[model samples]
Structure formats: structure tokens, C-alpha cells
Target: MKLITKFVLLYLVVTIIVLGIGGFVSYHIIKGELDNELKWRFLDRVERVTYLLEQGKNFESPVQDNDDTNLKIVALPNRVEPNVEIRDTLVWHDRLQQMEHNLKLVAHRNVDGTSYRITTYGALVESDDITEAVIQILLWILGLQVIGAVGVGFIVSNRLFKPFRKTLERIKNFRLQDKNPITAEETSVAEFDDLNKFVEQMTSKAITDYKNLKEFAENASHELQTPLSIIKGKLELLTETDLSPEQYQLVEDSQRSVKKLSRLSESLALLTKIENHEFTGTEEVNLSELIKDSIQSFDEFITLNGLTVEADVEDDVFVHMHPVLADILWTNLFQNAIKHNVEEGNIDISLNSQRLRISNTGNPLSSTPEELFRRFKKDNVNSKSIGLGLAIIKRIADQYHYTISYTCEDGWHTVTINLQN
Candidate 1:
């Protein structure tokens, strides 16, 4: 069950149990009190009748004189006779006939010929009526109380959870590279307020760690690049020193290894920077113009590689994104196409509102499209390009909340970037 339902069910169960116990106790107590009062009234009437008989008064006259609505009188003749046993005669007068009473009577002859017996009973008029009224009143009150409790519960629960809902929404919408921390005001409930504080702390810590890591990687890559360049230059100069063929081959191999290392380090540094959200200068950029520029820049490379370039882009397609990052994205994609394409292959670039797609005819990737975005994932065997190119584009798209996808058909590979609103 949902949280609210569980809460409401538990609350109602407790309330009902308490109310049931209270109502049961109250009903019995009130009934007992009413019964006691009826018994006392009956006993008091018995005493009055006995007193009147002791005074040698006529029972009928006393019954007539006593106007008690719940009282009655009776007289019975002596049963014993001088010769043999004789039957007794009994007479009774219900003075208050209209008054409803549950009566109990006992008769016994006195020593004298005149005899009387007292009777006791309760007035039935008030007990049932009063009990019904009490029950009705209690039920009405309980109904109102239950309604109020549910209403109050809903209001209180919603208010208490309001901060949690807001915190969840903030986290969902949060951008790691945006560098904006959660700074909402505290909630009324202490637990929720504390939770919000904890989330803020976590986000802040994550952002700090990301920045530090990216900075370390970028600095290390820069430092390595300088030494690798120096080594490559020195190796070129060493070719003038008259080395053996074997030595020359060793030098060339070492130079190639250094060049590969340099390229790998550069790609790693770029990937880290992109993931860290270092590209921040953004404006409304014309994507159509960017695509045209990319094609122009890669024109000579395309021709030299015997690749046909096709651009089917709409004009003035604008989007809000970092211009430098966008340029890098297009450049890497275009380069990947040229590098991986077969001789005399075709490259098609298309753009429309909020979408840019690049497809190139090349060898089918060995890996699935889903794995293509992962670091160090290379599809072409002879390609010197590090696998971080697509990964960098993916990170850029993620930082900007854009959507990117890859598709492969026959020998053609397609990459699409969907710009976010």
C-alpha cells in the first residue's frame, strides 16, 4: 500500500478501538445507574406501603392518596381456616396504570386476618428512551470527530511532506556542471528539514570532488604533452646522427609509442574537462552555420581521403549551447567519419529544428551502439583516433541535458544529437 493509505488505516484502527472501548464502558455505566435508580424508587414505594398498612389504613385509600406514578398496592385474604384449609383471595390495584413498569410482587398473609404484601418493580418509561438518546448523541459526536481527524491528518501529512517532494524535484532537475547548490528554506517538520540539509551537503561534496579530479587530469596531460613533444623532436634530430637500420626502426617505434601516448593523454584530459562541466560560455548559437563551417574545415581532408561530403541542413537553426563545445563536437564527429570511412565512401550531414545528424559509410562497428559511448571503445582497427571522441560528445550532451543516439545500418553509422529546450 501507499504511505498515505497505510498511515490513514493505522490511525483509523487506533481511533476505532479507543472509541469502541469508551462507548462500551459508557453504555454499561449509564445503564447500571438507571437500573439502580429504578430499584431505589421501587424500594422506597414498598416502605411507604408497609408504613401505611402498619397504621391500619385502607390499602386502596393509601394507593389513591399516594400519587407516585410507578407505585401500586395489593391486598390478599388469609388462607388458613378453623375447620380445614381454605383458599386465599387476592386483590390488587394498579393506581398508576398508564405508567409503564416491570413489576415483581410477593404476597404473604399477616398474623391477623387482614393481610398485605409489598411489591417491587421498575418504571420502564425512562431507561430505554434515555439509553437510545445517549447512544445517538455519542454516535453523532464520534462521526464528527472522525471526519475532523481525517481532514487534519491529510492537511498535516501534506504539509509535512511538502519539503520532501520539493527536494526530490530539485534533485531530479539538478545539473552537476551547473554548479548551483540547493538553497531552499527549511521546512516546518524537523526531519524533512534535516534531510534537505543532508542532500545539499552531498551535492556540494560531489561537485567539489569532480572539479578536483578534472583539474588533476588536465594538468597531468599538459605536463606529459610537453615532454612527449620534446622527445619526438629530439628523435627527429637523431635521424641526422647516422644510425643503423635496426636502430632507426627502434627510434621510429619509440616515436610512434610516444605519439600514441600523447594522443591518449590529450583525449583523456578533454574527456575529463567535458565531464567536469568546464565549458561554460554559452549563447544562442546558429547550428546551421556551425555545420557549414565544419564541412568547410574538413573539405580538404574529405577530398584527399576520397570521401564525398553531403550537407542537407536547414538554415538559421539556433540553439542555446556552448559554441566552443559545439564546434568540438562537430569537428570530432566529422573527423571520425573521414578516418573510419572506406575509400570513395560517402558522408551525409543533416540538420533540422533542434536536431543534428551525421552519418558516414564505413565498416560496421564490432560493438553495439550502446557500448560505443563508453571510454576507450574503438571500432576501426587501423584508426589512430582514441575512443574518447564519442564519449566526450556524450558527456557534453549530458551536461547540457541533450539526448544523443547511435544507429548502424549495413556499413553505415549514424550519430544524432537532440538539443534540449
Candidate 2:
């Protein structure tokens, strides 16, 4: 979840819990106060009736001030001890034809040895009034909370987090080779300022380290090429001199080894250059034309190996890319399929607007296809492959944000490259 969303949700939850507790407690407190007030009113009415009776007033149907309050006098069956009792009771209402809830206060006393029951009642109206008032109050509180929480949570938080968001965007756009430093708008928030500073420092250090590594790789590769060439030349000269059969075989093997080493060094240098994004310039190139040309160039090799080549290419599958890299990518893919196939194997090439697929009849891969994309990983260990072809292909695909995958089924190995728009 986003920071603003989480903060608002948490605030709302806490506010609800607090309001629920406060409302519950307030409800009970108001109810208690109303109960006490009702009881005292009933008690006072009972005292007035007692006083009237002691004054020798004749017993009659006593007057009721309101339907909610009543006074009644009843004769006891026998002389009872003097006492007072108060409780809640339900009285039937003649007019309403329903039970009316009331608080009944009764006083039992003897006057001249005559038993009399004097009772007073009061309706429980305070509870209903208090409840209605409390509900209205809670509604107001809830409305205010909704407004305050949403408005303050969204508006204030968005303003407060703006600096952090900008800082994060700058950090995400930071590139190791780019010389620009990460920056954001100045803010009063100290933490965001500190974060931007840290990000700038870190990116600067990363760019410096990357430059050092790239320069070293380029210099080392350039420096090794001259010595390798000199060694090959010397070996070629040595081969021409008079020598025994065994020595000649040895020299040939040495020459072959030197050639392999030279290829490996060149591949490594090319891989380094690809990673450093040295091939930044791009042009419109027709991939279909390139594939046909590559096929024609490899005709001799294919014929000598007794391999059959098939091409099902669409017309004018154009792409914008570095011309050299595109050539390398297609060459490596074609060579990979050819070099790994069996004798008299069939190579099928299919190309359309969206994808290019190359399938070759070959021995079942000893290693998984996923591992073949790692540097120096090969399916056929007995083959004379330096094992960097698929690795180079994968790096180029990644550079263009394209997808490449391999699959093997029924002695057929397929390499698919998905060209994205």
C-alpha cells in the first residue's frame, strides 16, 4: 500500500475505536443520571402523599398531575411494618392500551394502627431523551471525523510527502554511466533532504567505479591484441621452417590454440563494450534482408557440413537498432543453431513481424537451456565452443528489452527471439 493510504486508514480505525468507547461510556453515564433524577422525583411525591394522609385527609382517588406521573393509596390486608421500597415497574395505560414503563416508589406505614399503602410513579422519559441526544451528538462527531480525516489525510499528507516522492523518482532515474547527480526540490523535511544527499553520493560513487572498470577492460583488451598477434605471426613463421612431422603437428595445434584464445579475447572485449552501451547510435535496418544475407554467406559452411538450411522470412521486418549490434545478434543466433546441430541436420528459420524462431535438428541438450545463456556454459562439452554465443545473445536482448528463450523437444532445439515494439 502507498504511504498516504496506510496512514489515513490507520487514523480512521483508531478514531472509530476511541469514539465507540467514548459513546458507550457517555450513554451509561447519562442513563445513570436520568435514573437518579427519576427516583428522587418519585420519592418526593411519595413523601407528599404521606404528609397529606397524616394530616387526616380522607382517602380518595388521588389526583395525577400528568399521564407520566401518578399517586395511589391502597388498603393493606393486615397491619404491616413501616418501610419504603422503590423499583421499576410496568403499569397498564387505559387510554393507550399498552404497558407504560414507570418507576414506582411505595411507602408502607401505619396510621392509628391502620395499614395503608401509598405509592407514587414516574415515567422513564429521561432515558429516551438522553439516548436521542447522544445519538445526534454521535452523528455530528462522525460527520466531522469523516470530513477531517479524509481532507487532512489526503491533502496534508500529499503535500508533506511530495519531497520524498521527488527524491525517489530521482533515485530511480540515476544511471551508473550518467554524470548527472540526483537532485530534488528543497524541502523543510530534514529526512528527505538527508535521503537525497545519500542517494547523490551513492550514485556518484557507482559511476566512478563503473568508469574505472570499463576503462580497465578496454585497455586490457587493446593491450592483449598486439601481443597475441605477434605470437601468431611468430608461430606462422616457425611453421614454415624445416621441422619433423611431430613438430609440425605440434606447431599446428599451437596455432589453433592461439587462434581460439584470440577469439575468446575478442568476444570478451565485445561483451564488455555491449555492457557499457558503447553502441549507442542506431539506424533503421531490415532484419529480413540481413537474415538472407547471412544465410548466403554461410552457404559454403552449410554445404560442407551436409546441413540443410530453410528460411521462411517475412518481407521488410524493420527495426531501429545499432547496425553492428544487430548484425552480431543475428550472426550469433544463426551460428549457434548451426554449430550445435548434428551431421546432415536440418535448420529451420522462421521470421515474421513479431518474432524470429530458429529450430535445428540436434542431439538432445545435456544441460538445460536456461544455463546455456550463462557465460562459459555449454550443452555439448566435447564441442570446440568458447560458450559465449548465447550469453552474448541474451545480453543484447536485455539491452533492447526484448525476450529470448530456448526450448528442446524431440531432438529439435529452438531459439526464439521476441521483437517488442
Candidate 3:
């Protein structure tokens, strides 16, 4: 439901509960007051009737009298001779019939010769009418209050949510490539104002970091490219000059260094692109086929190094990932295994639903496990290694939400990639 509707409904429910309780309380209070007033008016009428009988002012039968304003009256004859008992008996019977209103009648006999009973009948008071009128007015007031409460709730809730709505609009229009940050100046609440400020800071920081990283990558690539090109050009020119065996060996080493530098630059560019989420569409790829292709490409290296290769991967264990990234990960891993293995060493490759484990007999890394995955971090023993192979694998694993771990035990270096399901 919309926020405003929810707020209005909540307000209505609370208001109704409060008004119902108030109405019940008012009704009971009015009823008690009306009953008390009737009791008092009845007592007053009884006093007046008893006073009239004591004065002996009645000239007609009390039952048939119409001059009494208190209540109806009925008279009966005495059962015995002239005595207080007989007079009390006549007054009791007369008062019983004279109780015309909704009230009870009782008799009291004094020791004197004069005796009388009083009629107790309720009276109709104006307060009862006023109480009914007030109840009706309260009902009308409650209805007006409910309407007012709903109106106010709608206005307040809408105002409170307005900033969030604008923030959503701004987010929808935001683009990562846009250098300028998206900010909101309109806010209806303090919490939203703070949120807007936080979002602006985060977006601005992201833009600044992206620009700096891109510039650094470009500048570093250009700086490295200049020397590599000069070395290649000089090597081509040295081909025409007569040189000793040692000079020829030096030229070959320079060419190899230039080639390695070119490859390193390409790898760095690929890592940057992957970090930027450049790969978009994805498809299911069979791991067994990918490993087979990688093995075929490195078959010559495996044979020349006299390495034993073992594969135990399933045929249908597939993953939904970017094909190019998957190829790069496996290629780097297989190449690293071949490059770091001992002569005639055994390389074991295994895959299952849980993970892919590659183990090879090679020189174990002396650094800690945490530092092994860091870019450009290699053991000082192997200066020829570029140190970016495992780092690229780490980047790919992160993109696919996978886990990569390295272990060295008993002269065997192992790399495990745990696939996320």
C-alpha cells in the first residue's frame, strides 16, 4: 500500500477506538446523573405529600384528588376502629395506589393518632433531555474529528515521503559514466537531508577514483611502451651488424624482455577492464571442454618439461559466466602451473560440483597466503615471473563471486577455485 494510505488508515483506527471509549464513558456518566436527579425529585414529592396529610388539608378522597401535583393518589377505608394502626393501614393502601410514576411506595406509622404513608414516584427532568442532546452533539463532533484526522494524516505522510520520491527519481536518472554527481536540494525531512548529503559524497568519490585510475593506467602503459618500442627497433637494426656470440645472446634477451613487457601491459589492461564490469552478456560454458582446450595449447610445454598431466573433470559441470573471462582464468592457471613446475613434475587437475583443484610439484611460495594474491607480488626467487597471473585469476574469481585459495605442502603448490552455486 502507499505510505499516505497506510498513515490515514492507522489514524482512523486509533481515532475510532478513542472516540468509542469516550462515548461509552459519557453515556454511563449521563445515565448515572439522570437516575440521581429522578431519585431526588421523587423524594421531594414524597415530602410534600406527607406534609399535606399531616395538616389534614384534604377535603376529598386522596385517590380521586386531581389538585395534587406530585403524583396519583388512591384512598381506602380503615379496617379497625379509630386508632393509629387503622389510620396507617388506610394511608398505606392509598399511597400504594397513588404511586403513579415509575417508583415504589412505602408506609410509616407514628405512635400519634395521625398516620400517613408517602408516594415515591420518579420525575421527568430537563437534564435527561440535555444529556441526550449532548450525546448527539458528541457523535457529530466525533465524525468531524475523524474527517479532520484523515485529512491531516494524508498531508503529513505525503510531505514526509516526498524527499524519498525525489531521491528515487534522481537515482533512476544517474549514470556511471557521467562525470558530474547527482545531488538533491529538495528535502522534506532531516533524515532524507542527511541521506542526500551522503549519496552526493559517495558518487563524487567514485567519479574521482575512476578518473584517476584510468589516467594512471594510460600513463603507465605509455611510459612502458616507449622503451619496449626502442628496444625492438634497436634489435631489428642489430640484425645487420656482425656480432660475437655474447652480443647475439644479449640481443635475444632484450627481445624477450620487450615481449614480456608487452604481455604484462596487455594483462594489466585486461584486469582493469574486468574490474570496470566491461563484460556484459554471459553464457553457460563447459569446464571440461575449456580445460581440454587449455591443455592442448600447453601440450608442447608439458612434453618438453617432461611433466605428467592428469585430468578428472566432469563433462557436464557448467557455469554461467563470461566466456572470455573463463578462458583467461584457465589459460593463466594452466600456464602458471607449467611455468612453475619442476622438471618431470606431476600436475593434477580435478573438478567437481564444489571446486576446481590444480596441484603441481613446484617451488613453494615463501610469502604468507594473504600476500600471494596481491598484484605484482612474486617470490624473489623467480624474477622471470610477471606476478600477475594469480592476480588476474583472483579478479575473475571475485567477478563470479568465487573463492580462490593457495596451499603449499610437501613440495607441492596447490591452487583451488571454489565455485559459487
Candidate 4:
């Protein structure tokens, strides 16, 4: 749940608890006051009736009273003891001719040598009226509380979270390599301001480190090229000189070693450039055409190995990528398939709307195809292969946010690259 929603729900729960307690206390207070008033009215009526009897009023005619209250006088054999008694009980009211639950108060007194008792009854308090009044009042208070709480909560939440939302947007759009990177935005909230300052410092440091590393790779690649060329030339000249068989073999081996070293250096430089995103210019390229051209370029190598090729490339499978990088990616994948395959093996290349797959029949691998993507990883120790081909393919695919996967079973290695439209 959102923070604002949780806050509102918490506020509502507290309000309900307080209102419940308030309602309980108020109902009892009002009921108590009403009970006391009813008792006092009963007692007052009894006193007035006794006074009228003492005044020697004649009792020849029937007396009438309000339906809710009654007064009666009775005579006894002797003077009655003077006392007051009250009880809640059922009494038959003569005027209404029905039984009623009332507060009955009786007073006994003597006047003119006659014993007489005066009784007064008041109707029971209406419980439903009291409940209805309390409910109405509580409901009004509850309704007002809900409206005010929601309004105030919305205003406070919006103000409180504004800085956080702005910070999130800045982070989302921040780019490390951009000339103008994101900076910490000033905020009234101290914690939010501190967070922004920390993020800005971290991103700046990371960009500075990346630039230093990229510059070093470029300088190192340039510095090594001339030395490697000189060494290869000297080794080639030595191979042509008159010498013993052992010396000639050593010179030939040295030449081959120099060539391998040069290729390894070039591969490392290319990998670094790809990582640094140096190939940023992009254009629309027909991927099917590119694949066919790559396969044709390798026709001599494929013929030398006696490999059978099966290509099922669809028409107009287009992609957006740097022209040079696109060619390098396809070249690496095709070379990897041919370089690792067995003599007289078969290569199957399939392409459609979703993905590209290159499956080649090769000697069963002791290790899985996943290890082929690591630098200097070679399945055959005797083969003069610089093992950075798969690694380069992976880097290029990653740059495009494409998915590349490898699966090998039964001497058939399948490399898949999911193409994006």
C-alpha cells in the first residue's frame, strides 16, 4: 500500500476508538440525569396529594390525572405510620384500564384520626428516544471528523512527499557518460537534501573513473602495435636465413607466437572499445543481407574444412546498430562456429522474426559452451585460436540489450541471439 493510504487508515481507526468511548460515557451520563429527574417528580407528586388530603377535601367525585402519572388516596383501620416507599413495578391504572411498568411511590400519613396512604406513579423513561438522540449526535461528529481528516491528510502528504518524488525522477534520467550529468536538487527537507548530495558525488566519481580507464586502453593499444610489428618482422626475416633444423623450427614457432600475441592485443582493444560505447553511430541494416555476406566471406575457410552449410535466412530481417559493430558481431559468431567444428562437420544457420540461431556439429565439449565466452578460453589446446571471439559477441549483444544464450549437447553447439525489432 502507498504511504498516504496507510496514514489515512490509521487515522480513521483512532477516530473510531475515541468516538466509541465518548458515546459510551455520554449515554450513561444522560440516562443517569433522566433517572434522577423521574424519581424526584414521583416524590413531589406524593407530597402534594398528602397536603390536599389534610386540607379536608371531599372525595365524592372521581379524580382524573395525566395518562403518564397517577395519584390515589386509601383509608386504613388506624393512623398509618408516616414513611415513603418507592419501587419499579406493574400497576393497573384506573383511567387507562391497563397495566404499566412505572416508578411507584407510596406515602403513609394520619389526618383527623384517620389512616390514609397516598401513592403516585410516573411512567418509565423512553429508552428508544435516548438511544436515537445519542446516535444522531455521534454520527454527525463522526462524519465531520472523516471529512476533515481526509482533507488535511491529502494536503500534508502531498507536501511531505514532493521532494522524494523529484529525487526519484532525477535518478531515473541520470546518465554517467553524459557531458552534463544529474546534480543534487535543493530541497527544504534536510534528509532528502542529504540523499541527493550523496548520489551526485557517487555518480561523478564513477564517471571520472570510467573516463580514465577508457583513455588507458586507447594509449596501451597504440603503444603496443609498433613493438609487435617490429618483433614479427624480425622473426620472419630469421625464418628465411640458413640455419640448423632446430634453429629454423624455433624461429618459425617464434613467428607464430608473435602473430598470436598481435591478434590477442587487437581483440582486447576491441573489447574495451565496445565496453566504453565508442561505437555510437547507428543505422538501419538488413540483417539477412549481412548474414549472407558474412557467410560468403568465409567461403574459402568453409571449403578448406569440407563443411556443409545450411542457411535459412528470411527476407528483410532489419535491425538498428552501428555498421562496423554489426559486421564484427556477425563475423565473430560465424568464426566461432567454424573454428570449433570437426572436419567434414555441418553448420546450420536459421533466422526468423524472433531470433538467430547457429548450430554447428563439433566434437563433444568437456566443458559447457558458456565457458567459451570467457577471454583466452579455448576448447582445444593445440589449436592456434585466440579465444576472445565469443566474448566479443556477448559484449556487442549486451550493448544492444539483446539476449544471447548457448546450449551444447551431443556434439552439436547452438548459439542463439534474440533479435529486437
| Per-residue lDDT of model 4, residues 244-345, tens digit only | 999998888888888888888889999988887778889997889999988898999999999999999998988889998989998888888898888999
Model 2: residue 51 alpha-carbon error in angstroms: 2.7
Candidate 1: regions farther than 4 A off = 1-215, 240-250, 380-383
What digit string (tens of lDDT, one per residue) describes model 2 on residues 40-135?
887777677678778987767665655447778887889999888988788787766877666778888787678888888766664456677888
- Which residue pairs clash within candidate 3? 63-73, 63-74
Q: Quote each prediction's TM-score.
A: 0.63, 0.85, 0.57, 0.69
Superposing every Cα of model 2 onto the true structure, what RMSD results? Answer: 3.5
Higher lDDT: candidate 2 or 4?
A: 2
After superposition, candidate 2 runs with Cα above 4 Å error = 57-67, 70-136, 183-185, 276-284
Q: Candidate 2: lDDT over CA atoms?
A: 0.85
Q: Write the candidate numbers in order of decreasing lDDT.
A: 2, 4, 1, 3
Name the Cα RMSD for model 3: 11.3
lDDT of 1 by residue, 121-216 (tens): 444344446567767877787787778777876886678667777898899988777778786568777888888888889888877887787668
lDDT of 2 at 55: 90
CA displacement after TM-score superposition, residue 65 of candidate 3 (Å): 46
User: Candidate 4 has which clashing residue pairs, if any?
Assistant: none
Write the residue-wise lDDT of candidate 3 on 1-421 in tens digits: 9777786778777877887787778766765676566656555555666667667656333443233323543343433232111111112225345422233344343323544444433334333455567678777977897788777866675676777778878877775566788675747578888888888888888889988887798789878888889889989799669989999899888888888888899889888878876775689989889998788888888999999999998777798889999899998888888888899899999988789999999876678856868899887644778888899999989989998999889988889999864
Candidate 2's displacement at residue 165, Å, is 1.9
**TM-score order of candidates, top first:** 2, 4, 1, 3
Weakest lDDT window of 10 consecutive positions for candidate 1: 81-90
